[model samples]
Target: MVITDVNEYRLELARKMGVTRAVNVAKENLNDVMAELGMTEGFDVGLEMSGAPPAFRTMLDTMNHGGRIAMLGIPPSDMSIDWTKVIFKGLFIKGIYGREMFENLVQDGGADSVWPRSLADHYPSFLYR
Candidate 1:
């Protein structure tokens, strides 16, 4: 439920969208926020929408054991991370290419329907509507 962005405007939007915590990683320390929220272990799941390497590294650093991450963004170039973290933490990372959506939409018509409703259900629908 905690979301991080360097952009203040995006963080504001995330707060309005009902995120439990919206952190500007540029100005605030994520560890402090995690401590405040009593997340002594770390996040269980992460969605990497930003292609920034630093953000990806931060996600890796802040995940708990057996954490799951779904990456949608495509990085422009190669980036390195602490492989030990991934190996020892046993984190699961998945690259999400678009093909999976076709299968999902076919298997469950409900998946096809959720996109339009998701804006109203979870996001700031007023902007799009």
Candidate 2:
């Protein structure tokens, strides 16, 4: 399951990545969607890529006890967190920064830079104006 802001492109990407469920967090009731995804109590793993504070909080709130959350979002410096829940739930939080390995792979020709370009070209009408 994947939750993201209302964007068909993002949903398509998640579907291609084998996501069985994709919830548009920007539309309708998020709690209802979470419930539909069986995230009522919480989730086992939550990956936050959206930089919105609310999204981060929602992810935290919807995480199961002893669950892990990996965040790549860049929140504001003065952002607040519910430390009480963190401690009580025994949640594991991991923060990631930089693209060292990805850069290395690009530089070493292990990955192709033109791949994205090709994909974009393949769906020009869908991606471009």
Candidate 3:
């Protein structure tokens, strides 16, 4: 699932990228949607890209046992979270800042040069054209 504020364009993009669901977090009940999707206590991996404290909290709350959360969002300076819940749940909170070596290559060069030739050969035409 891809959570966005209220951008239909982003939702459509997520759908095009094969997301099972694209939820507008601002307009809907995220908790209910998560429950409906059977993501409660079953999701092993969560990528927090919304940068909102509420979104981070929601992701942290729903993580399953031994789950990992990759936080790529940039929260406000005074951001707060439930440390007790995180500690009690034994969740692995990983933070990623900036791109890795491979992603750096993609930034410096085009995907055709950074990715394997075989995979690059199948690059989405729309991305280039």
Candidate 4:
């Protein structure tokens, strides 16, 4: 898997963890780096760990069609995303908050969280629910 970060230390950690490709966004061009790494169609799944607005946007821009994204970090107070692309490309974005919220709930309770149940009951089209 490819890990993208601005910190050298984190890149090194990712590399040590078996990620052969890591992008230091502060120093290299992301598209060029991905291209050099032979990724033409972009990633199939993206784990948005940084929660930086730019990182989130980049993930949205670079994911393949029908891409799924799980976010772990806290979002910026003033974040903005392109909803048009999300709808057209059939992107699925799920927010994973800290212990008190969804991700932990889903993980610990196996889709028993109120959010998933609500979605499943109300919006049958959303299969993720």
Best by lDDT: 1
How well does candidate 3 match the true structure in TM-score terms? 0.66
- If ranked by lDDT, best first, what sequence of candidates would result? 1, 4, 2, 3
Model 3 residue 44 lDDT? 71
The local distance difference test score of model 3 is 0.69
Clashing pairs in 1: none
TM-score of 4: 0.71
* Model 4 lDDT tens row, 8-125: 8767766655565878988887788788988878787787878799898888888889998888878878888998878877998878745655455477563442233432433557
The candidate, 2 or 4, that scores higher on TM-score is 4
RMSD of candidate 3 to true structure, Å: 7.6
- Segments in model 2 whose C-alpha atoms lie over 4 Å from true places: 38-40, 97-129
- The residue ranges of model 3 lying beyond 4 angstroms of the native Cα positions read 1-5, 40-42, 97-129
Candidate 3: tens digits of C-alpha lDDT, residues 31-125: 67777887645467777877889888887777777787888778998999999878887888878845563474487563443233433334786
TM-score of each: 0.76, 0.67, 0.66, 0.71
lDDT of 2: 0.71
Model 1 vs truth, CA RMSD: 5.7
Candidate 2, position 97, lDDT:
43
